[model samples]
Target: MLAYIGKRLMQSVITLLVIITIVFLLLRLLPEEGYLGAAAEKMTPEQQEVYLTNLGLRDPILVQLGNFYSNLAQGDLGKSITYRTDVPVVEIIADKILYSLFFGLGAVVLALLIGVPLGILMAQMKGRWLDRLGTGYIVFVVAVPAMVYYLLIQVYVTDFFRLPMLFDEDRPISWILPLISLALGPIASYAMWMRRYMVDELNKDYIQLARAKGVRERTLMFRHVMRNAFIPMAQYLPATILFTITGSIYIESLYSIPGMGGLLVDAIQRQDNAVVQGLVLIFSSLGIIGLFLGDIVMSLVDPRIKLGRGESVR
Candidate 1:
């Protein structure tokens, strides 16, 4: 297990370096004008040269990339180009990432708490009213665009309940609507997947064998069926948890949550290369790490599964 973990960690580092290189090269391909927004546009030619030169934009691409990695090794993510020019990119992200993380964390917890039980109930009560209800909810959430729900919540729920529409740091109640919007789709997804997998598990030979052995119904349902059925679902757990840090673009925008989503949008809109590159690097790293961690979790959850060789015990 330790060897497997060490191998995965090494692979993750290599993958991150490759991602950073790709992003750096892509950002370099953009025209010099791309980095200059309205704020930079007002500067005279000499002043602009001075600014770009100071940013090392005048350097060769290879040199710039080298410098970027060097600074990255030292924990410098560069200053924002369009936002707070004096503020480091990491500092800006640090200030806002927590709000998004909390919102995402809340949404995931809500989805798991509600979705898994709902799925188990649906599976246990197959073809009944509970199953139909769960199926309907999955369909409804899948068919509707998330934007519509966000709009509805902002327009009706806020007005009817007299709750704040926009997020306020000091006002915790403002979090409710955004959290709901974010959780809605995930809840449907988790419930539907859990139900489908559980149904499959219920029909397996082990279930029949367990029944023949006179295991209690509850034990059969949870201890046997649930544990086996959840292996596939467990693979997604780490990624879902890590995504809280990335935040939902739509929900953050709708709630004005001052999270990573909004910051990314603003950075792209203003062509803040430094901010954009920094954010992309962070996101890419998280995505890679999340997948690696998910695999580790899946292995741990099911002792039959082996990581390095991709082998499993029957």
Candidate 2:
């Protein structure tokens, strides 16, 4: 198990390195000649060189890449060229990542809170009206696009309650809409899928044995059926998490929320190659981290997933 975990760790590191290197090369290859603009053009050539130097743009490509990795190894993400304010990339990511995390996690958890038990009930009541109602909800959730749902909430719910658009000056409104937007897809998917599979699990011999032992319906559902059901759902977590992350760019854009999504969008519009590269690296890392954590948790629950040496679920 330890060996398996160690192997996965090494692979994740290599994958991250490759991604960062590709981003570096792509940024250097782009046609833009180092962030030319009204502000940049105002500087004399000497001043421009000095300005670029301060941002580490003066170094050779290889040296710059080396320095980036070296600093990154020491937990220092380089300063943004576009922000031009000597703000570290990690610091920026730290601020925005929490928002992304808030939205992604809040949505997924809420979806599961509602979707899972509903799926279970539907599965148990298969062919009944409640099952049909649950299935209808699953379909309804899938039919509506997240953007449209977000627009509806922004217009009707916000307007009706006369509530503030977002939570505060810095944070968005309890991150509720963004969370729901990210969650609905997975929630719908999980309900339809888990319902079918969990029903099958409940029909198995082990479940029947548990039921025959006078186990209450709730106990049978929570203790026996849930564990079996979770193993399958656990496999979905990595993909579900990545999907939520990718969708946030769209959600944040729709809401005008400032996050990594907005940062990336702004960087692209302004042709700020440095910030663009930095943001992509950070976002990619977030996905990888989620996958890694999911694998660790899966290992704990099942103990069959071994990814490296000297690594365990604990």
Which candidate achieves the best lDDT against the true structure? 1
Give lDDT: candidate 2, residue 257: 69
Runs of candidate 1 exceeding 4 Å displacement: 39-41
TM-score of 2: 0.79
TM-scores vs. true structure, each candidate: 0.92, 0.79
User: CA shift at 173, candidate 2, in angstroms?
Assistant: 5.8
- Whole-structure CA lDDT of model 2: 0.73
User: Relative to the true structure, how large is the alpha-carbon lDDT of every model?
Assistant: 0.86, 0.73
Q: Which ten residues in a row are the worst by lDDT in model 1?
A: 305-314
* Per-residue accuracy of model 2 over 1-314 as CA lDDT, tens digit each: 66666777888889988998998877777644456545676788788777667666668989989987888789776666565545777777677777676677777788778778788888889999999998887887778776777778777877886755554545445456566667778778878888988888888998888778888988888887877778767766876776576558877776766677877887777667667777777777767777776767776677665445345333
Please count the clashing residue pairs in each candidate, in the order shown. 0, 15
What lDDT, from 0 to 1, does candidate 1 have?
0.86
